[model samples]
Target: MVDASQFEKLTTVAKADGVQQLVVGAVVQHEGKVLLLQRPDDDFMGGIFELPSGKVDPGESLDDALRREVKEESFLDISAIREYIGSFDYESGSGKKSRQFNFSVDVRAAEPIELTEHDAYLWAPLHDDLPVTDAVKDVLQKYRELRAVRRD
Candidate 1:
């Protein structure tokens, strides 16, 4: 379940912390691997891999932003927002201080992952050296710890 209060607390805290922009990322896991998307060399933060994420439009809920972003970037509908994987602050292309709230999510399907915004996609194994930014790497680490605890 999607909890509006939980999402509200996230935004509330971020605002208190003076975060200028809000973004949401999804960790879509399948077959022991998590999804990663490669940016186009010509785009912002190009030639780097990242989570399927996007900016949260004004007045939009964080959970809704996550679902919309995952769908927009990968054409994969989110089935569930499983867990909150914490967040990291960064400077976006527009030089705004942005904080991304990441979550573990389940998609409706695993096939025909049509890419709309990225040049390529990879199903990276959890233990490998992921070529993502430090922020994403940290989120994945927390995700790994959570998965381990759930299995025990």
Candidate 2:
């Protein structure tokens, strides 16, 4: 288990050092399947699948950034943020130390996902061969575990 106080202190230190980027990701579920987006072939980590995510802007809150990113990438609105899954750190393609804060969100409307950044999309439960980074897989597992606990 994660020590909450130690995690907070580490986060604070990372922020103080200006060596961490705060990125937010969403796990949007419908009909028991989680939404995943396929990156365009030309982008970083291209051709891999990932959640709807982006960096938080300088003046924006995490929730606001998450909502904006989801809309910008998929044209889907987040109706409610159901739970904070957890966070994981990884070095981005550009060698930047990045931390992703993930959450489980509900879509505002049952509309089609109009993809602007990705080439394709999928709705699947957690699996080993999803073509995402290990960090992303960890986040997905965390969400799955959280949901199971809530259902109990």
Candidate 3:
């Protein structure tokens, strides 16, 4: 079981250096499959698959950002946040260092995803073959671990 306080402490330390961008990724799971969004061919990281994510706008809380990003990217409302999958850092296309905080979430309904920023969407098991970033893979792994523990 992850100690909530410890996780918060780690997040604080991770952000102590000041993050250029704070992003949030939502791992929306339904009926055992995870949701993935595909970037448009003309956009940065084009043709790549990623979670429903976006940078947190100024003055927005992390939870609020997650909710907004998911709605904007997938048009799904997050009903509950299951767990904090964890955080990872990577450089964006503009060479800015960013940290993405991931969370496992449940949507309010099993509504069809309406994509605006992405071109396509997929709902597949975590172990299935998919083109995604290393950071995303790490988040999925953490989510799987947390799920297994919860089952126990």
The lDDT values for all models are 0.94, 0.80, 0.84
lDDT of 3 at 126: 77
Best by lDDT: 1
Query: Residue 97, candidate 1: how far off, in angstroms?
Result: 0.7
Lowest lDDT sum, 10 consecutive residues, model 2, at: 1-10
lDDT tens digits by residue: candidate 1, 50-90:
99999999999999899999999999999999889999998
Model 3 misplaced stretches (Cα beyond 4 Å): 1-14
Q: Note each model's CA RMSD in angstroms.
A: 0.9, 4.0, 2.6
Stretches off by above 4 angstroms in model 1 are none
| TM-score (C-alpha) between model 3 and the true structure | 0.89
- List candidate 2 stretches off by more than 4 Å: 1-14, 127-129
lDDT for model 2 comes to 0.80
lDDT of 1 at 143: 96
Per residue, candidate 2 scores C-alpha lDDT tens digits across 53-84 of 99888766677888899999889999887777
Worst 10 residues of 3 by lDDT: 1-10
Please give the ranking of all candidate structures by lDDT, highest first, separated by commas.
1, 3, 2
